[model samples]
Target: MWQRGAVTDSAPLDVDLALLGGGGAASLVLAALDRHGVRGLRIAVVDPVRRRGQDRTWAFWGHPGSDLDPLLSASWQRVEVATPARRRVLELAPLRYAMLRSGPVYDRAAEAERRLGAIRIGAPAAAVHDDGDRVVVRTGGDGPTVRADWVLDSRPRPPARPGRTTWLQHFRGWWLESDRPVFDPDRAVLMDFRTPQPRRGVSFGYVLPVSDRYALVEYTEFGPELLTDAGYDAALTGYRDLLGLPGDGLRVREVENGVIPMTDAPFPARPTPRVVRLGTAGGATRPSTGFTFSAMYRQADQVARALAAGRAPVPAPAYPRRHRWMDAVALRALDRGSVGGPEFFDRLFDRNPPERVLRFLDGTTSPAEEVAVMNSTRLRPMIAATAGDAAHRVRDRLRPTRPAPAIPAAVVATPTPPPGTGNRST
Candidate 1:
């Protein structure tokens, strides 16, 4: 528990790097720094809240040999996907779908921090400024202005409004334990699109069962607006009824809820010379699938490598240009109603081998494998999204460009972010 303190600015504490927000991304960096045994560098991670519990769950399909793989809670060899008219079960050979709870991973990072000696502050960063040689970050409530050689801001981006070229993968889930054995402990439902669809968006349900009687089930939407609490409750009720998990016999244990930005809006990893955006804000989340863990892990390695080499870090993207291009295309199609989620997903799964599709989604496919996956998609959405992208590029080329107005030093002010400013689900 944290308490409000007197707004007194303290003396400067110097460090090699300061992580603005201590969440999964910061933890990954701490773990990496520890693994590399990088010495003579001080580090600190500051966040207002203690990021405890299973705040979120991340699922991905991979070969599972990373340092974090040992923290995996559950994995499945076979996964199922359903549409209104079709059901498909994919057997993932060489790669399996896996889940990791945040608790153990958080604990592991805590252990790693013993080496780096990074402090996690319980306050929001008010503002960050690149002061030529170093970046100065001021926290709210007159908290000590943390100065470091570099800053990585993992704060969630602002909310989306009308007129943005973005979609949201919003979800609400319940962890349930049933009196009767009602779940397949060995399998996971990738997506069940039998749920009632919104007027203009796609919706689905997922089930990850840990036991015959325990599972985390949720309804998700890739749409314009997030579902209300009541709406999510109704969807969950329908899913339970469909699965024949009775109301009286089922006990809801806990709930998880979040919204992830699905966009191609230019998210430059570095917003300032001394500060680099990390995690989802830095474009780690896959725009199409809303996955982030694997991408963030790759990014951590990139940043750690640059620091070890004693070079100014210009972290490479976790995705290739082609991967980003395809992501933009898919998002555009979904936004334009040219793509229906159930059918779009079904086509990819039904036409391509599961490994190939997973590889494509993971952004690890070769050019040839990419071509094969593109061949499986509906051509109309591809054409539409491609045309839109081309038009935007041409418009930019033809239009006049101007430099951004500079902020005068006399009038500069950095406001404290409201609590949980950059908060987003992984």
Candidate 2:
């Protein structure tokens, strides 16, 4: 059983939880809390954009019958990894590669909130203050300030340095219908690093086929390169040419473009007392992988359990400081140019078992497994750099009396193994 109430000027709108952000992360947390039987908590989701629209796609590896199975809009049993040197066709054994489009997820979440009752929406928060005993959230409209015992902020952080090493992981996909069937709809082209490598960073082409005649082709990168309309035209031309496909045979449909952070700067976790951060703002996304939905869900579960037990939402069991450190190490490697982008991933996949790799990305691998994974990358340079960086970071932490060095402006921004490469068929 849960309790629900509205805040009045006299009562000051005190609720159990106040969530900022209406994106996937916030929704997942709300859903998890609801499922944990933490009911009647006056919840408010604040976001500037409330309408659901197609944004980006989320892909993750999961067991066949996982809890997230129902949320998947599409999935593939077979995935292909291609590099200039070699190609590997893997069957996702015991696990499947799943994708959930953003629109449906947002719609589902909105409906869920309505049914659950006491969950408010479309309230744009102006600012939040920690008053020690309670957190006060000031909003834009006439709505009264929301005071909560706990608050979860999931707002996307602004890039630490603007225009420095800016890269849009953007892509244009033609949901094409071919005159004649060309693609193996059952198989997904995970990475085609066969394209020309960018000198400043790394780039690759990917294709996700939904049917024999329909698929999405996209080009992605890790450094500053904004393609113009003409540039996209030329690149798509080159992609089709390289794939030995006739562009005239396919009919174009929809397109998508997205920019993701690729920096190593530490995202702030402590904002104010009784008000915690969630989603990417909370460092839920792996700085290297830009994957956070699963991590957010896991964190939500922990928070819900804590609330259900009548405990302070302080120690979320899912995200440990150690996991954040590992993400920082990987991001540092990229920022320092210590490893080539493609080769870094190639070595990772080649050395680690798919399951172990998945576990590491999910932030759940044990200490022994973590050691094994570190050795598998054969990233000696990265290993050495990480050790040195770790020592320096620790020393700085201990010597807080010393002035903290300013973090480089450009060094902030930015998981997962697809299952079944060990045994399943494509």
Candidate 3:
């Protein structure tokens, strides 16, 4: 049992737990706690802005009967993956690919905060200090100080350690409403590699059709750099032509764009004994594939279980150690030009069953299944990459600590959508 209190002028706002960021991570953690029937805990969620609009889109493949199914904007059991040479349309029987807007999630979180009597601090956390016993969080601009037994910090920060290879999964998507029915709402294109490839890294087109006349078309690239506004728009234009959509009748209702880090850096979850990290900061984003929503849920569930069992609230690893090692090798190969990105991914889906491959990507494959999936890829190059990456790690460990070279401004800039477009952060 815990006591709830309001902020006072003389002392800090004391609570059992403090969430530094009121984004998807904090919300999910709170939901997990509720699911486990954990009660009587005072919680405070601190963030500069509690955005509650349709600011982002989250897509994942899962079996039906999830509580979030009602909030899905679109879902499909059939998906298409294509290359210039061939295309495979897969039917996912037990698993369905789903897209969910952020608005419902934010709305549900707000309702939970009200019902749970949780405090909402609409201020940016300037700093979080774990003082051995209690974690103290200071907010920006003379905001209230929050002291709690545990702190879950989800605020974004640079990686604590440098990785051998890092790539940005950057993209711009446009929500289009057409004058005529053109899209097949039943099928979603996961990756269409018809777009011209960059000198380095891979580029692909993704399409999610919500209706016959409405869809979200995106141009995505996984590389060390981001594209300029004109560059992304130009690629989208070319992709639109390739899809044979009418030129003049398509209306861009909204635009979404963001960058997700795909790296093998060690993002330690427990920064301090009582301070835990969540979201991307806690390594929720998968390095090989920039998928995070499912991983975040898994992390949150672990944290809840720990607390319920009278243990410290610590989230588990988003992916197993062996999985991370495999992702590291894959990233290294992609960065070193040892594997052509399109050909590699094409071979993965073309040679293996879609269910096995998708499960492997989500880090749920058994050891034998994983071996089979690995066998489907070009084994020689991957084996060479494994050896090279291992040698590099050994060399790095023996060398003195050095700061990573600064990335170029053009390479790390947050992509901006074209003029006259509303933006959503993902």
Candidate 4:
């Protein structure tokens, strides 16, 4: 193993793996690799925000006795889905909804890294390039260069087309506590469409009750809306009014907010030779669901196994070309105003078995299950978009024979607002 704090002025420190981005993907991969007895592999995690105290929660559906169950701090047995036309409560037998808070996850990962003594922290990688044989990662702030046999990049990708169209699904949630039991703590309100739908997209509210008196109430949108603090306050008020909950009497405990990109950009799975992409950067996230934590866990496990066996880390076969095509079709359908935003999902839940549909969303369903999902949707426009995207992809792949244009490193460092923001209705 390389000695800690040892760096030669002109030497690249050789390592097994270097992970970029310290979000859900990086943490999950590190944890899985540690579990598999992959020791003495020089691993370094690079992220601008290394210290974690962020208020974010990830929720996913898992069967009983899943490996993630032990890590969940809170969960729900029942989930509710609602639209203006209908409302349904799914019992979710054999499957439970689970949640993990970011703070605890960071603490656990940091402790594990310290115990293993195989990983390095606080090194924010600036650029990664594949130098024919190995992947070289340049770090910021005079940090030593790390040359790893394999590199996994988990950075979020900007939208493929500038000003094409984008929307941010962002929300702020207030943890409310009431003197008396005000919520059904055992159930999670998945989606309530009582809020007004935007002309260009859709909007809804979600509620997750953690206890008899405490709950997370969130307002979400799938279209453009960069909400100010006052806008979020108004949304909370509107949600309370629609739910018939006492707004004036409720006690506020804590608040959490986040924004997730909803796009159809094809994030490359393999960016360079010997370098693999993980997490959202690798299309692990379902475009329709914005759920990536569980997917990242599964992807990380596959990657760790491959590394242990001396194989290049390719994403699992479950995420085939068909899945990418489906996402592209759906995104185009939404973008072109071919389908009503809420109606599309409403029809999905109303027509298909909830479990099968959820499985498809999780990228765990079989081919037959995927067929069933396709049959449930209106097919003409979706199919057209799929064919068009396929043709475009093929043409682009065949025509790409030119050298990459020179791009200054400073150009990539500029922070811009994520896509989908411009199309949102005020």
- Which numbered prediction scores highest in lDDT against the true structure? 3
The superposed Cα distance between candidate 1 and the true structure at residue 15, in angstroms, equals 0.8
Candidate-wise lDDT, in order: 0.76, 0.65, 0.82, 0.69
Kindly provide the TM-score of model 4 when superposed on the true structure, using C-alpha atoms: 0.85
Give the runs in model 2 whose Cα sits over 4 Å from its true position. Answer: 1-12, 119-121, 158-174, 224-233, 314-323, 387-426
The residue-by-residue lDDT of candidate 1 on 1-426, one tens digit each, is 222211233655566788877788877887887787766776767678666657667788888576767888788989999988987888998898988877777787777776666665567898888976999888876467778998887777542222125677788777788888989988899999998888877899999998899988888888768777678788888987876677777776767777776766555688778888878877787878878878888888888888888976557887898898888788888878887888888999998999999988988899999888888889977898889977866675676653322111101011222333422222
RMSD of 3: 3.3
Question: What is the per-residue lDDT of model 3 for residues 356-414, given as tens digits with 9 covering 90 to 100?
Answer: 88888888888898888888888888999999989989998998866644321111112
Using alpha carbons, what is the TM-score of model 1? 0.88
Residue-level lDDT for 194 in candidate 3:
90
Expressed as tens digits, the lDDT of each residue in 1-426 for candidate 4 is 445523324346777777787777777777777667666666766566664654457878878786566767678868888888878887777777887766666765676566556446456777788986988888877566888888888776643332223455666676677778888888898888878877777778988887877887878777655678788778888987887778555766666666666565555678677877877667676766667777777888898787677677665742666775676677667777787667787777778877876777787878888888888888887787677767766766676444322111100011122332322212
Which regions of candidate 3 deviate over 4 angstroms? 1-10, 403-426
Clashing pairs in 3: none
Model 4 local distance difference test score: 0.69
The residue-level lDDT of candidate 4 at 355 comes to 82
Of 2 and 4, which scores higher on lDDT? 4
The local lDDT score (0 to 100) that residue 97 gets in candidate 3 is: 93
For the record, the alpha-carbon RMSD of candidate 2 to the native fold, in angstroms, is: 7.6
After best superposition, candidate 4 residue 196: deviation in angstroms?
0.7
Clashing pairs in 4: 166-419, 166-420, 167-420, 224-424
